[model samples]
Target: MDVNKTYKGVALQEVLTLLQQHENTSKVIAGGTDLIIQLRECKVTPQVLIDVSSLEEIKGIEIIENRVSIGAATTFTQLVNSPFLNNGLEGLKEAAKSVGSPQIRNIATVGGNICNASPAADIIPPLLVLDSELYISDINKSRTISLEKFLIDKGQVDLKTNELLCHIQFNNIKNNQGLGFSKLGLRKSLAIARISVAVWVEVEENTYKQVRIATGACSKLGVREREVEALLLGKPVEEKTMQLGAEALKTQLEKRLAGRKGMEYKREAIQGVFKEALTKATYLSKT
Candidate 1:
């Protein structure tokens, strides 16, 4: 909590060197929305802060081949306004828009959101449904891993002490595919999500050729509802099928949150959220 050393205007190489040298004692700061709060509460007290807010290596969005690559420091506002996201990635755009408020969106970076690893993070469910992959680097080396595999638990991730998340990339949805997102919160704006769901579907001849469903706030980490996805894959797209898939998700949540407080509410709430997400994706695919 006490003031110490701060490094700024440094390049990526310098940041990595400082991180490698200080290891656990040095913390990276960007946006500072979550880290500032943690520091204020004395949850983390690093002796050195390496500010990566302006690092060029992690600050833009690019389209390479069939994948959309987003820099780690790209803010939520940038995501919401990007024309590229309109091309079948509306779910991600909506998720970025749903975070806190205009001010928060302007400052909160996608990397910060992912690195925070909060179970209720709005962007995680959408990213999971996108089948996103994360790139991580350190002074010594770099690696890539699936977003799902990178998240280990609440407030924790697979990142090493000296590693930094560089960017995220996911393949674009094909012409026959669509994505959707739904969130349940106490209010329409500036409300933390109580339960949220995202759906991605690939349709062929009016049937579900592939289905992916991810949920947030209902588990220790945002996760894919594999049982629900399994139930819907290869099934005809219809109201009845969607209802059944929603029920499958409800059952899965029951098992995942057994004995926890608010379990019943989550089980019941997931039904509507899942249905909404599926309906949106189905509609978009047909259009």
Candidate 2:
């Protein structure tokens, strides 16, 4: 990638202050994973670049007393190797694994993924199911926002121009909760997702306790299939229920993407994927 300039060996506070100073002209470059590609494609150009890839405050995963918090600068490889994340946030770990080539995964930051806000971004579906929240900071202030309401549209988020993505946090699944993640792409390797789904369910006393089913690529954003969830609530986790839930999810997706091409493939593919995922989650939680 070609660039007019580069900034190195800068402190985190310096970068933040630089962004604050430049304001409209500044863009933070962490890992340069998405920014380089966008620049090469001539998609965007900013007068100033504030590099923060080496900032310690933006680079770890922690499971605190209440929730799991991952720094914005944490890379895919870090998430994949994290025991706490791998064991508890399997859906997120799996989604991170599904990203591009090894080199791309090594350099792509979680903050970039969230900020880029691609409708097809692989991790968004899993995060939506977690009902995650983002912590965004600027020189002046910081705020927390829900995942559902944070992503606005294609290539847009609730982030202010000078603000930075600090971290992402979400509670762990309850003791009896089961979670699963899957993505359908043109190829299993580097392709962007064509359709993705993540589901979580909690069972107690042989009955459905709570459920969150999220689907991406079909909608303008990742979405919860509420009608199907309504059907699954209090329903037994049997083959019949799985089939019904999956089929209903398919129907809802079809209705949502009514006029779009590729609906046929997405509708059929999602049913099988959702069923397999929900079944595995339910079974694994029992074991």
lDDT of 2: 0.79
Q: In TM-score terms, which candidate is top?
A: 1
Off by over 4 Å in 1: none
Candidate 1 TM-score versus the reference: 0.97
Cα-based lDDT at residue 68, candidate 2: 86
Clash counts for the predictions, in order: 0, 0
What is candidate 1's local distance difference test score?
0.90
lDDT of 2 at 193: 86
Candidate 2, 41-63: lDDT as tens digits: 87877766778788888788998
Best by lDDT: 1
What C-alpha lDDT values do all the predictions have? 0.90, 0.79
Taking the tens digit of each residue's C-alpha lDDT, what string does model 1 give over 1-287?
47498988358888889889889787888889999999999999998888888998898788888998999989999999987765567788888999999999998999999999999999999999999999999998999999999999999999998999999999987878889999999999899999999999999999999999999999999999888898898999999999898888888988989999989999999999989988888877776
CA-RMSD of model 1: 1.1
Residue 189, model 2: lDDT of: 94
